[model samples]
Target: MVCINCKLFSQLNKSVDEQKQKIEDMSGLMEEMGKEEFISVFTEELFDALSKMIEEKKLSMENAILLLKRIGYLKTLKRIHYFGFEKISLSERIEKMIINEEEKKEEKNEKLLVGLCECYLLFYSRVPSSEFLSICVPCLLKAALKKEESEKAQKEVEMALLALSNIYMWTNVPKELYLSEIKEVIQYHQEHHNLTHLAYQSVWAFFTDRMFFEKSLEEVGVNELHLVREAVRELEELTKNVIWMREKKDERGKETNEELLLIRWFMTMKIYLRHCQLQNEEFVGLFNSIVQMFRAAKDNFRKISNECMYIFLVAKGNLSIEIEDLLNGGVVDVALEEMQQPTLGYKMMCYNLEIINSISWQLKGKKKDEKEEAKRKATKRKVLEKMEEKGYEDDIFCFNEILDILNEVNFYDEALSLDISDYFVNV
Candidate 1:
């Protein structure tokens, strides 16, 4: 047992090191090539490489999942910035090809479908996502609703829901595109037992803070009063005594887990609670589930990835309710201690910068209660202390947009969704 654990730990570290080195190497090359030439070459190469892999059926399921996450992370990188992406003709070509592959497939190529959903997010800025979304939305819904019970099938369903959740979360999806299916979507699980716990979270997350169609949802007889309560109930069960320590194994241990889905879920949850209009009774019930997650995280050595989530949600959450629960549950102590160590990846690094910016903003809001205002200033001081606690510092995280948040003063009144586009991957 000890040897097996050692092997897994060693492999995890090796993968993290390789990813860090990849970022360092890419940064060096991009500097030499300059942004314009670099993006052009990178874009052309990506389409060329993926085309061959898909054509020859060389995209194994394992590689396909990795590719989806890689592309998603790569999309977040500034060097591969989307501004220049629109100028390139191949941007549209690649986007169309991803969708076309899904359209023409005889059997559902789960790999391709997964890739297509993530790729939609990758090129949403460059591609006309509206038209393609019109087609993909219903198709993805059909895929999610299928009754396949195999392990592979269940994973596909989970990924499909994850894709939908992310698409809705990041993109300002047009109401017309998915509004017709709103009632059916929220009500699907009520009648069926096909969705996983994660899937349920993902679907409810799809509607989080999307007020553009709230009236439309209500018009279709979707009851939010019931939906929010049920979601909270399930969350209570899913999180009971759950430890946010290890990545859940997938594909029979061939892979650990995709961090992006969980990250996306946290993002959705912050907004979900805000818009759910949590009833007094449900608020405490829902928060009890959240409190346990933090207790578990702190008890388990504050795993780096999950730690990112704690800070991410803390800084991003609007109301005092969610933030107070997290802080009181020991997120503050663990987050302060864990942050002193180096981060694992560019995503983790971006999140670190994000947490500082988000929390530091807490110091700037108006004085409501004298005690409350002093508490806000104190929170800022603690974050600043931990940031410099490690000693050596020199703008190691080069996120100009992120770092700028520290110096700015803004009121944290309403729960605002932070701009995710500002985040980057292996820069």
Candidate 2:
């Protein structure tokens, strides 16, 4: 009854529970305080809880992560830059935590490892110092490549890929060394749906960076186009899966998943359009595929409408014939319908109008290029006739309604200065 070992174990359990409770309480406290004030007051307490959790072997990694998540650590890390707290100190603690988990001889500690990596990524997103990148890149790469056949390990790998993607978003690393590692993950885990999705996102992030996009292959010292080709292949496979998922009769909560894939696919297409000049048949085929997806996706319009706006924006000035056909081919109908919905946000409504404006200006330009006045007049008549058929006049009326709403919302300056003319001109 008076055993020292048993007494010590009981005390350790109490302490662990107290730390978890403190993390839970901090969640409510965060809501009351401004971000800077919250970080200043609770940073030490949060740090101590994490440190104790790592030091004591009492709590499982899952339990520790649950506590951290309850405190909204990831969301806080996103806005870390706005605060005056000691970021370096916090980063040092997380690095130590990662290293400690890595050295553990027990089970792989996947939850704790992924949690620490999540913290690293959020911190890196705000600071992006060379010191941070040096520590983070290799650690995430190792975690991403670690092998475990368990379901828990699969979740860990997904988080690792996501963190790597976040880091790659801000920093420029040697692609030759790490791109293949990411590709290997995708190629090996192609059947693991979530893992493959994250891997493709990582690859997309790497190649779509402004530095990579702006530089030539010889200048960058890598065959990025080859990487782009590989990513396209992966994207095609993912799109097929999404289509299959859509075909299931009882599928629910698939909207978010479909949106993610569509956005990523459009992003990949934007990269290809910019770099390859939209000449590749593969890229053209993908473009057509997305157009068809948009046409067929009747119930999911709200989820994909913004992405459709961006695609139209990118297609402007690149393909005149295709642009005219798209404008006349019911895109105008889609945009008009979305704009009239009372639930639609103002920014999205603006984007919809911009798409219409771009298409209209392009069609106007094409009409001007007709040499014969009679032919020009005939083309104008045909375009107007098509617009009337597609309710373009109603869209023009809605443009004025958008202006009135903008004025009512006190965005009068934006409304007054808004230019639908020359909207097709490249910015």
Candidate 3:
């Protein structure tokens, strides 16, 4: 056993070294090509190598985490999807490390603990092991709660909060663990310029998790309607901050970081809107914000527009929102315009079809007389006419497939019924 462990450690160290060297070599290239482009180009190669190492059982959780630390958090997150890191026994290993740390209480390694938390976060989509979370969550909470006033302590707290955010993305973090600390995390994010985005992400994740929202409402013994109204107010503040950042001019013409932050903000708001009932004015305001974003966003960020459209369609179906309301927001017009774009992908084409089918069904239900019925037919015809006029007739097959799908499935009902996990994947 001792020899086996030694061999594993040696192999893990070598793997980490190799990954570190690769990252160093890619640094110049990363600068020349943006991080996103670089990651897209090399993701397959990186994933293949990491997957092989894991499959061979040559990379232990400890070393895998060390490798992530070397590569940095964002890159590690992008690479892990290809690495299939979720298939490994990371939670068990991290749990063991936590136990060891507890045993050596006087010699605490905050860095290692933070790394373990980060690793667990990277695989958060997989539903991190309960044992690991039970241990790590409290450890992180404690670290975050420590009242050290030094810069090092502040950095450590930021890392812990980030880990907590990642944890909240999947699991319901207990109120006791976070209720006190979350305020501090938010304040730190507001006050600290360096890691504000990370802080905002953590807070957004915490607030948007269904479990957290429901639990908080229950704990406060407040009517969900009242609680949701308050929550919406907080979300508006968060959105305002993100929008302010996005409005600021940057030399690059496009601010990728700000745009991403805005996307995440909208995503969180979508979650809240889905899970909670809102006042009519609140709902309309939120819906309008989504449409405005869809209109203002660049073509490169079509996913944001797609997500906004999905949310609108889902709301229209589930909330019994009127066709007139949708038309007033120019939802139909926007859907037609998006569908006519030649560069739209197969997935987006499917999405646009879903939106059109949703509106068509709503209009059908609202038709009480021949005049209204005629209007519905004309509306559907207008969509087809617009498509033809925009030269989307070349993709007539896709349009026909969409009609068939509408016949088979109710898009809004199907979408609203899906897990948040499903919605976030395309986003």
Candidate 4:
């Protein structure tokens, strides 16, 4: 499992490195060509390089700007001229082009690259605006779904989709486009489960973010009620169905298969929890089930992608009542046992416990009455030390689970469903 994960991450890194090398190689060729030849060749090469960079997710906004400058494809002055403003204006040009298409096809292509470059830049910076996303996302979506689009174009579109989903929480585009694309992605996954999981991962990011619903989803008639109803139904059905293999398998094989299954279940849990939180229905029941699922998988170290799954679960819990339940459910014992094998989840749990302890200590000084405060501090210290002795201090997942216990014990205010930051991956 570790090897496979390493291999997967390595491939992602290698792909990025390859794109970086291509941009570097192309930039070197720029000064050798004559001006006219450079413009034509640069245009061709820029399209190819940026296309690959975007597809591979190796492109950053700074990189895009740097690449354009290195190749002398367009003067920064011309880009500023087209956008009619300064401060990263690629999306601005896209907005203009979409609104008024007076440019020739060649200019339009250049504008598209600029637009894509800006979109990517906005995402990497972790800040975005509605106008910027609206200008570029619709075009990218159209390009991705266009049957006549070439393979290279499609790959760029996919990269754009992934980035769009990531920063989508910051912007508000039309929901119709997002919904349509998401539905298509779901259908594609249903047919081809072994295909790349990027698209699959992106759906979660789109759904979890609050901006998507407040800005775009309502316009698209996404029917939050319908999604909630479907999620509830799906969760219940999935919870009931489990494959039991009687044939004996070695530890590694068993662990690997179980981890995969839990990951899928975790995806379902995310959907159900997000929908429940969105609808403002009672989220307790949904969260309760999620806790149960994690508990069910608790004993299986070999069969778990512990850290990532723990991150998902902890992020979902996020100071909610679910955190309390996790603690009260004997997280220390389960985590300790799981830690003997040291799954990633167990390590994360330890970190989470540490955070909670730190927070609790900081909040203690604010309390009145030194004696009462000291007593409270002592109790909190006991829990913290116990967790430490059990080898959980460094694991965030452990701290999160401890917080869950405290929540269950009614130490803090009851949880209110907060804005679901849809940036989190669903599965």
Candidate 5:
């Protein structure tokens, strides 16, 4: 069994390896070999291969479910509208399968994705009608609640919920389909173990799903506000766990799992700050605690520490003085300087520089006071140019919208409001 698992994992590894080569060729062919190109190429291969694997059924349940998630995420990156929800035939099949196998724990997940390729074919063709949006996908939830140890099943349930959320939003399907299922997914995630991140993502899906219940939420007295508060508590607990905190230790003391958890937490916290915009007292307390943790961490969390600080700045809404102090204060600059040193990890150096450059871009000033703004913009342009001359242009945003946001807000309170309000929209 273990050998078979390894072989299956190798299939994914091989696909990734092939994708890397193709990306390299594409990068060489493009005039600009930057982070955006890398992200785009990697994302395409990741999703395409995942779709293929789902068709082949070559991976284990856990791996197959992960691939399904990768598909969801890659579609998200492309800003592709109405992913799985558009596949009414496939949605009905998956739904019926769940209902049919309601009691067969190991059996249903065994071949749950056999027709996934057909679904992808229809999904990519964009011919699937909007009516697919009305399908109720929470049937998987009924299955997941019974098998608590099934991470694979739990993830699939979340994917189902996410698909329904997309369909409801994209096609303007009745809010009832979206709201009832979303609340169930949220409830399931809150009660389930090892499903925190999925729950966090669902919160965003619900809020952005058909503008969520903007008018309905107010009238129905459904308080997503409290859910946001609960999520904050969950994240704080995850971050502070001993396993996760081990990343704060030095090289010899740090473990890979701990480091990985830190990376995950960084992403989770970012998602929270990005979507929830929950302004409750619990959220405020958790946010401050995270900032303090960032201040006290050791060098092992170097790259992740920068990410956390970036999130902190974004969350606090004080990019003006707060970001300025952090970046210029030698914390980020010195760490970045050390990574770039010849004796350090060269690839690591490249990666670190990319992250730091993005942070710097976020921190760049964009005052409307012409003389001062011009001076700041020129300085920023010079800095970016210098970095680009050194062969790094991955953090380049086509527009200055990010800088504009930082300039507009000066504290976490303001930043949180910005996210929830749809003011300063990404689109």
Candidate 6:
């Protein structure tokens, strides 16, 4: 017998229950049906559903938003070539669907504007159409800049940032066109909320590839650019069970959970650090906060270790962090202790060794302040002493890999031994 439980979604209508059920079914449909079959059967219903949500008052705004959210996930399955929809009209009465600037989302609106923003994101690929950017940018900015102390407000901000992230997938977002507002939105979230992964990538790209290198971050008006440190501290509060998370890694990130948030969160920070400089105090505070997170995210140490190398590489003189800053931030202690751990996996070991190598390599470089030479030598001598004992343990089976890394980093082992002391030589 044909079952009601598996009723074909193509037979669905705009009735709230059926629409909701179909929205839920699309996830299964993506897996069960081939890509073309899924698109052919469901694409008409999908856009039609979005149109009904936009044009009709029958579906609750919550369900409408949920429908768009489901579509967003399902879109990942198909490799969309060009988004110029020929048969379907995505832009019909689209401008009227969005709430205008004068219209505050009052008690009566039922989040009508929120659904429209989601709809905007659904049609995001074609947003560059001449009139659409003008219509949508203001609506997005207004929502993006909203700062209220409630759940609903957070949702609006997230929607806007996620949308902005899409608007700015490239490094060359024009400063006056919409980027100034985009920058304001990023700063707003940094103070109040965390950005979504997509948003973080754009933010990273924006800052790392700043159009004018001579202009400081302050010059660009990201004067309160404590986003990275704030995000790191926020992570410290949210994280505890890295191993629990890793076990469900495949299942996680579908809803962009804590682990995925962290990976993207630091990408934004690392990208900024890669091309720009932070103040000495801020840089030290940021590194220490990362150390705190490293301590907290115990099982995810490998992830942290991989990211931490970027910070160390900055000391090779992106001009923000220095070797002494890393040393002061207790980097030496962490590397020495972690490198000796018998439990460390390959990537984790490589990261720890890289950290040690970066520190040693930078420490051996010439310092401009000739007066500080004696103190620098003393510091290097002390670090070498620790590495002498703890750097390379006897348990390593990855000898060739280790040797290869040694050669690449140009380890100065004039001592003619491949011991841990090989990390520094001649200096």
Higher-scoring candidate on lDDT, 1 or 5 = 1
How many Å off is the CA of 143 in candidate 6? Answer: 1.4
**lDDT tens digits, residue span 1-427, model 2:** 2242232223335455675665555455444444444455445544554456455666555555554443334333223433322354555666777777777888867656667766666434354565555556666767777567677676566566555555533356655546566556655555444454654565455445534424443222124344435555655565565543244322322233544656656665555444443233333444454555555553445455456556655655355235434444455556656665667676666656665665555556444344644554554565566556656566555566356465455431333225534332221
Model 5 CA RMSD to the hidden true structure, in angstroms? 14.5
Whole-model alpha-carbon lDDT for candidate 2: 0.52
Among all windows of 10 consecutive residues in model 6, the one with the lowest summed lDDT is 247-256
**What Cα-based lDDT does every candidate model obtain?**
0.48, 0.52, 0.53, 0.42, 0.42, 0.53
Candidate 3 at 352: error in angstroms?
A: 4.9
TM per model? 0.48, 0.57, 0.57, 0.39, 0.42, 0.63
Give per-residue CA lDDT, model 6, range 1-427, as digits (tens).
1232235434445677877777677556454544455455545545665556456565555665675555553443233333333245544444445535225555535346545655565445643543555555555666656657576666566655555444433333344545566567667666655554444444433444443343455335334555555555655654553453343433322322555556655655655665555444556666676676666555644555556644544444454466666666766667667766667655555555556655666577667888677767877877766656664434233443465554555433321125555455234
What overall lDDT, based on C-alpha atoms, would model 1 receive against the true structure?
0.48
User: Residue by residue across 264-284, what tens digits does model 4's lDDT show?
Assistant: 445434543434323323343
Top model by TM-score, which number?
6
Q: Estimate the lDDT of model 6.
A: 0.53
**lDDT over C-alpha atoms for residue 225 of model 4:** 26
Residue 127, candidate 4: alpha-carbon lDDT: 48
**Cα misplacement distance, residue 277 of candidate 3 (Å):** 3.1
Q: Count the backbone clashes (under 3 Å) in each candidate.
A: 0, 0, 0, 30, 7, 0
The TM-score between candidate 2 and the true structure equals 0.57
True-structure lDDT of candidate 5: 0.42
**lDDT order of candidates, best first?**
6, 3, 2, 1, 5, 4
